[model samples]
Target: MSPEPYLGDTTRTPIRHHILSVLVENKPGVLARIAGLFARRGFNIYSLAVAPAESHARFSRVTIVVDAESAPLEQIVGQLDKLVNVVAITDLAPRDALERELLIASVPVDDDNRLTVLDTITHGGASIVDVGATSVTVMLAGTPDACDELERSLEKFSDVELHRTGRVALPRLG
Candidate 1:
């Protein structure tokens, strides 16, 4: 086994809460390069979200979370921009960003149920994405602060599982 490489000085205290926004051409291995960059730099990413940015062409918007000093983060983005497919890369975590979060909870079903399915729909912006005899998938998207409140409401039901995606944010363009 081999130890991972460090992107910056291996001795510095950790710097928390850094976000990277990437615009890359949607291709077969584009994602690999982006992920590789972080790994090569010895950066530990906290959250990653990638989705299609353009419908016409194969383009994607990737958001990655890391803890690094200013110079390292800047260099990471700078190097990425130098690539042929990298359209743009910005560290949006410390910038003027708009953030959102999503939580999907699954609840089990039983013979005697006090709170019916409809009861769950009306609370906490919960929307039924799927429903079966055994479980139900309810999705809620909003600020992280409110996610806790929603979670509490779901506790009353037969919640069996929870899935959380990392917080996502983009600069608030004026």
Candidate 2:
């Protein structure tokens, strides 16, 4: 099966990142099947995030970011649609979507640099979630760029541990 071309300027050769919002059955192994398809097709996934969808346990949402130049977008979408558990797929345009990622960082903060660390976090619009005598854990939910900026600033601190959730997005509605 072949998917219809939904992306404009299919002839363009520049590498562009695309976000695919997939709705699938929440049953086991659904994620693996989708991921397997990408692997078999030699498509590289830049980031992927999966979570429950709506208020029901019967569906899950998988948000995947891929480089369009790495594989034919139509072919990828077609293969994904063939999966038995897949319900829907939406290709979100970066400018027309609301996207966010969550980042958590644990930084060593002694008396000397505690204020500096806190100030950096505050400047990044992040909040301290946990504070210990020697370290502080902060959480930030924002765009990928914002998270990257925060990560770079936090790197100056000692013993910093950081983790980020992949991008997740929903199309904007009028």
Candidate 3:
């Protein structure tokens, strides 16, 4: 289904999370302007990811996940559209998009439980990216649910550090 346009009345819609994919000029200050707009309007951003778009040097795509309950989605999109550097904006429906996040975690591994730790990583479909004397860094790139499962499994071990990329998504092709 196509997304409702920002010009329409959207306040009647139930409050929930929304993901906005915005394409903007790849120049300094664009990110700040978009972020400032949200901040000035008191919109709470859940997660944001930005990168150059499809190898293009002049454009970048920003994926922003926000709680629509904080503010009307139309208002937020309208304000974003008004920005000078913003080229386009698309609201990505969760069901119609492919979303993924990258997780990196450091788990302590020793002679006693080294095999167990590797087993956990293997079962979770993650890869051991680095190996240290006492710790191994594992990397997992998968859906949020998969990442959560991996995190829970890793908790069984001694966790030294963990980090995850917020999220990035694209609409699925027919």
Best by lDDT: 2
> Which digits, one per residue and each the tens of the lDDT, describe model 3 over residues 53-172?
998999999999888889998999999999989999999766666677788999988899988998888888788888899999988877766777788888887655999887788886
* Count of steric clashes across candidates, in order: 2, 0, 0
RMSD of each: 10.5, 8.4, 8.1
lDDT of 1 by residue, 56-146 (tens): 4677888876666534776776767776888877776544566566778887866666266557544565677888877777777765545
**Candidate 1's C-alpha lDDT?**
0.67
Q: lDDT, candidate 1, residue 96?
A: 58
lDDT of 2 by residue, 1-174 (tens): 112212223123223778899999999899899989999999889899999998989999999988877888888888889999999999876666667788899999888997899889988778888888789888887777677778989989877999999989887778
Best by TM-score: 2
Candidate 2, which segments miss by more than 4 Å at Cα?
Answer: 1-15
Model 2, C-alpha of 22: deviation from truth (Å): 0.4
- Listed in order, each prediction's TM-score against the native is 0.68, 0.88, 0.85
Ranking of all predicted structures according to TM-score, beginning with the best and ending with the worst:
2, 3, 1
> What is the Å distance of residue 101 in model 1 from its true position?
3.0
